[model samples]
Target: MDSLAGLVHGFSAAAQPEFLLYALFGVLVGTAVGVLPGIGPAMTLALLMPITYQLEPTAAIIVFAGIYYGGMYGGSTTSILLNTPGESASIVTALEGNLMAKAGRGAAALATAAIGSFVAGTIATMALTLAAPGLAEVAVRLGPVDYVAVMVVAFLTVGALLGASVLRGLAALGLGLIIGLVGVDGISGQSRYTFGLPVLGDGIDVVLVAVGLFAVGEGLYVASRLRHDPPELIKIGANRMSREDVGRSWPSWLRGTMIGFPIGTIPAGGADLATFLSYAAERKLAKGKRRAEFGNGAIEGVAGPEAANNAAAAGVLVPLLTLGLPTTATAAMMVAAFQRYQIAPGPQLFAENSALVWTLIASLYIGNVMLLVLNLPLVGIWVTILQIPRPYLYAGILLFAALGAFAVNFTPADVFLLLVIGLIGFFMRRYGYPVAPMVVGLILGPIFERQLRRALAIAEGDPLTLISSPFAVLVYAALVIIFVVSAWLRRRRSAASV
Candidate 1:
């Protein structure tokens, strides 16, 4: 009953005209970025930081949440139509999504993705609403050592799970740690890697790195590949799914929601993992004609994974809101945004900013409905966006990338730094290194170090004190189990292939 009243109050707060406008704006921008290759929600949110910083805290978060959902929805369009998954989570969707497009059921594929996202998003958001308070209460009692252990687990899992090779993921993480360590030491009051440059004294801005890597680097790569022929686009046919299609998708959507929400709540459970798991589960569950259609145009393929992707996105917010822990790059950027307003997220958030938290939650419900409507009826419009000329598209992207970077501090040096970082990002992409681990590492590196140091300081500099607590011990044990299981699975898969 308390939860019901709080939700009702939240709906009232979020229904304000201005808040609704912000939500709409966020969804539109998020969809645009998601449809464009290489520009994910993290970069879009980072680039918009300057603009969104001026807004009220609740409003800013509402917009950011909208962008988060919009980006997830928009990625399915590109994955099905272009065979280019906009978000890594959508990669599993493309496994059969593009084939569905080729088979002329592109409309059905897209419908399933859009509706599944809505169903899963709504279910997961409700789960977040009910579970977040309990999680926050648990998080409030955790000690610094436990937090350090949690960070270590997150770091190890993110590094291990993201890229094709664990070595590559670790390498990217190391680079991020180095980049994060560039600024003045918060504890020691000493500059570390300024290189005598005044700009470097403040350290590299997270926004600059995100823009350079996600926007400028992608623009440059796209420009280089402009000479290649564009992929053939499938024309829109029936947008409505048949009764059979609807029946097949609903169960998969429910299962995906069940699978995704719990995984997302975990420190290492990301959208990519959830989507792949959902896909595998769906494939296993399918029988008869559906089983034969796995390699062909399978509607279940698009429905299940897309649902899981959106659900996992919602799950990430649970940790971010309840514990102030960011589980994804997008969540990391959101932490930066929250810090900009000096509104720390955690147990205190609900106590001090209950209105803001509740309103944000309610707005998510509204945004999900909005995204479903926008994605379904107007998909043709989004597809037409693909017809945009590459030269102009990339040129505009470069312009915005430069402008967004410069807007950070109104300094020319930021522009130069963006270019340098862009070049680095290009090479990283060329070499098959994943950008996400590096981004995650850069964001979490400082938090991990700070927690570890604090834990040690309290224990009189004993390193073993970091895991003395039962909670810390449990976290470490989980990390070890994850590593062992992952290694064994890899070995078995290799043996089977051979």
Candidate 2:
């Protein structure tokens, strides 16, 4: 009943003309960025961060949230039409979607993706609405030690889950932590890694790192791999689904949402994992006749992964709102947005700014409906965007990256830092390091440091106090179990190979 009342109040706030306009604007820009190959929601949000400072807090956040989900909706269009995936989460969709397109069923593939996204997004938003407040209530009671434990959990989970290898993930995380420590020490009032450089005194901006790693690095990588053969654009002959298509896809959408949303809400269970799990689930559930279509452009393949992607996107917001813990790179950028607005997201955010929280939740549902409407009839338009020359598109993105970096501080030194970081980002990508963990490490490192200092102060420099609290002990135990299991699994795989 309380949840119901809260949602109703939230709708009232979201329904305001101003907030609705921001939501619409956000989705429109988000879709555009998502349609462009190699650009994901995190980069898009980071690029727009400077401009958002001019808007009201509610309006800016609404737009950011809209972009988060809208990017998921638009990511599928590129994978299906151009055989290019805009986001990693959409790669699974391309396996089946592009094949369906080649078979002259592009329309049905796109339609199923759009409809499945709507269904999954709607259900997942409702789950977030109901789950967030309860989580926030519990989070508010946590001590500094517990907070440190939570940060450790985030670090371990994200490090273990994102990369192809655990060592690579930890290395990326360590790099981020090192970058994060470059600025002035908050407590000691002394320089750490600045090395007499004034620009390094403030530490590197998160936006610069985000844009460089995702936008610049990804763009350069794609440019380097660009082929002389022009991408074959798939035509959408009939943008409608048949009854048979509907029958094939409806169950997959439901199953994918069921598989995705729960996993997404858990820490480190991001859209990539959710979509992969959903694809595996759908493949396993297939029987004798349908099993053959698993790799050859089945409608179920497109529908299920698309549903899972959107569902996981919604699920990721649960922790962001309740505990202020960002589960994905995009969520971390959103946290950065909150800090920009001087609005901290956590238990205090809900207590003092309930209207903002509720309104943002309501806008998610509205945005989901808007995405369905925009994606369905506008599929042809978005596909047409891919017809633009790759050289021009990438050049424009680089220009935006430069402009956004300059906007942050108007300093020439910042521009220099941007180029330096972009080079680092390029090497990181070439080495197959997971960029998300680096960003998470940079963003959370400071918070973790603060909590550690506070906890030590409370215990008179007794480091053991970190594990003295019951909650902290439990969290550390869970971390140990995760590490042990991961090691055992690696050993088992090694033995099997031998």
Candidate 3:
């Protein structure tokens, strides 16, 4: 009842004229960026985080939340019309969506994707609204050792499950941990890795690292792969769907929502696995004729995976808001955004900032509606956005990245650091190293360290105390279960692919 009342108040607050405009702007920009090749929401949020530093917290939160959802919606458009998916979660969408486009059913494909996203996203946000508060309440009772256990789960899952290989992911995470430990220790007042530089006294700003790795690094990498001619985008023909298409799509949307939301809430991984699972499930459930269409351009293939992708996106927010754990790269950037506003997203967040949290939640509902309205009517605009020249697009990305980095403290040093980190990011990508674990590590390392120290201090430095609590034991046990299950899932998926 209290949560419902708070949500009502949040709707009232979020419905204010100014806030509505911010939501519109965020969705517009987010959809635009999501349509562009090689630019994901993580990079867009990183670029915007520094730029949004001066806005009121509520407004910024609304905008970020809009981008979060809008990007999820827009990626389907790219996967369908363009040569490749803008993000990995959309890879499954591309498999069927692109086929649909080539087969001249692009309109039906896009329609189902847009509508499925709306359905799944709306349902999943409702789930988030109800679930987050209860989780926070339960999380409030947790001890430092429990938090340490949770962070360990976060570290292992994000590093091992997200990328091409576990070793590379762990290596990237180590790099981030090293960068995060550069400044003077808050408790001990001693710097560990500053290398005796005056600038090291303050530590490297997260804004620089984020903007550098995502925006600058992505820009440079894309630039290296730029072609002389723009890749052709499939024309989206009369954007409408048949009644038969609707019947085919609705069940998949619901099934995908069920599959995606639960996967999202857990620390197992992000939307990629959820999408694949949904795709496989839909293929299995299809009847004789529909099964024949699976590899070509089945509407179910376009609908279910897209729905799963969006639902998983909503699910990723659960751990982020309630426990301050980021399962996805974008969630990590969101944590950085919260930290910039001096807001931490753990259990205390609800009691301390109920209004803000509820408002953010409500705005998600509003954003879903806005995304559906915006995406359908403006398909032409998105097609134009997709056709943007690689050179100019990348140049603008780097320029915007530089400006955002410089705005961190308006210091040249920040810009220089941005470039240096960007170069490293380019190398990381070039060598197939995952950057997400690095960002997650950079953001969560200090919190993990703090919790570990407190847990040890309370135990008089006895390491065995780490697993003494029942909750901590459950968490660690869950980690082992997740690893074993994930390994089996991988092998099964590989066999199916073969």
- For model 2, residues 1-498, the per-residue Cα lDDT tens digits are 777887899899999998889999888878877887888899888778877779988899999999998899999988998889988889889988999888888999989999999999998888888788888988899989999998888888887777778889888888888888888999999999988988788888888887778777767877777775667888876647999889989999998898788868766548887787788778878888788997898888898999999999989888788777787889989988988887877778888888888889999999998889999988878888877888887788788888888888998777777777877778878888888888889888888899899999999999998889899889888888767755664574356436
The clash count of every prediction, one per candidate, is: 0, 0, 0
Alpha-carbon runs more than 4 Å astray in model 2: 480-498
Top lDDT hit:
3
Rank by lDDT, descending?
Answer: 3, 2, 1
Would you list the rank order by TM-score, best first?
A: 3, 1, 2
lDDT of each: 0.85, 0.85, 0.91
Against the hidden true structure, what lDDT does model 1 obtain? 0.85
**Cα RMSD (angstroms) for every candidate in the order listed:** 2.1, 2.6, 1.0
What does the lDDT read for residue 172 in candidate 1?
Answer: 80
Q: What is the C-alpha lDDT profile of model 1 across 350-438, one tens digit per residue? A: 77788888898999999999999899888988998877778787788788888888888999999999999999888877777767777
Q: What is the lDDT of residue 435 in candidate 2?
A: 83
Off by over 4 Å in 3: none
